[model samples]
Target: MQTYPTGVAAKATGTPLTTLQRYLQRSHITLQPCDVPSRGCGENRGYSQRRIIQIALTTELARLGIGPSRAAKAAFEFSDKGNTGRPVGELYPLGQTLLVGLPDGKSVVINIPPDKSISDVLSNDSAAFICDCGYVVAKVLSNLSKS
Candidate 1:
């Protein structure tokens, strides 16, 4: 597993440095500890690729007006649900769009058979929101590489 420093992780996850700092302070997220802790202020801790993805998804939830803490919790649950091997981004087909239930703060990835659209399964006025896993994963990976 590749581990990224704070600045790189923040950039990779599209999370602001201060926001990551706040989460670390409250123990919402922890770094994959290093041999020598302090390389500098932002580089003191190292975050894993998994952690970066978690942060990125949390921001996805936050866009729905959910606060950071709640979003982080939901993201954590979604990412590591049941200690499952695959994370959220790869839970379904790479480009699959997931229908997220906001009420319970859980996500369900239903396999969309070929020739069927996601809209075919749910009504238009659904309280649920759709998430494009492919886009999210690509964005995070692309940024992670750049950073």
Candidate 2:
């Protein structure tokens, strides 16, 4: 797996460094220790390609006026829901509502809006909001793994 330093990751994701650091602090996003040998007591950590993609997605979510708390959860959920071994960017154009695939092969459809919270969308009992993205992200990720 390719790893990126914080600076490089911030640049790659087009996120401000401080915002990225805040995301790292608030989210359960996985990170790895830098593989390079260090001479000092403190060793540098690195972000994997996975983490970089997550940051990029989170940045996009933030651009939609979503705060870090929800954005973090969304990022994690998107990653989990789209997991098929492909790059995370393959999951773009997430429909208004996302149908998350569960581990048991079942799915949970989540309705989302810029003005409403995710919890609020879930609590709304309207069938009109229920729809799937056709698992397009998942398929893209799967194809990426095959290649």
My TM-score estimates for the predictions, one after another, are 0.70, 0.51
Candidate 2 similarity to native, TM-score: 0.51
Per-residue CA lDDT of candidate 2, range 1-147, in tens? 555567776777678998887876775445534223234667666666556655665676567565656555555555444544333334433435464433333334354555676557656443222223334334333533443
Which whole-number lDDT from 0 to 100 does residue 81 have in model 2?
47
Model 2, 107: alpha-carbon shift in Å? 11
* Candidate 1 structure quality by residue, lDDT tens digits, 89-143: 3555433545355555555544455577776765453544555545666788998
Top-TM-score structure, candidate number: 1
Model 1 TM: 0.70
Candidate topping lDDT: 1
Q: After superposition, how far is residue 19 of candidate 1 from its true place, in Å?
A: 0.9
Q: What is the C-alpha RMSD of each candidate to the true structure, in Å?
A: 4.3, 9.6
Off by over 4 Å in 1: 30-43, 82-91, 94-99, 109-114, 120-128
Quote the positional error of residue 65 for candidate 2 in Å.
0.8
Clashing pairs in 1: none
Angstrom error at residue 137, model 2: 10
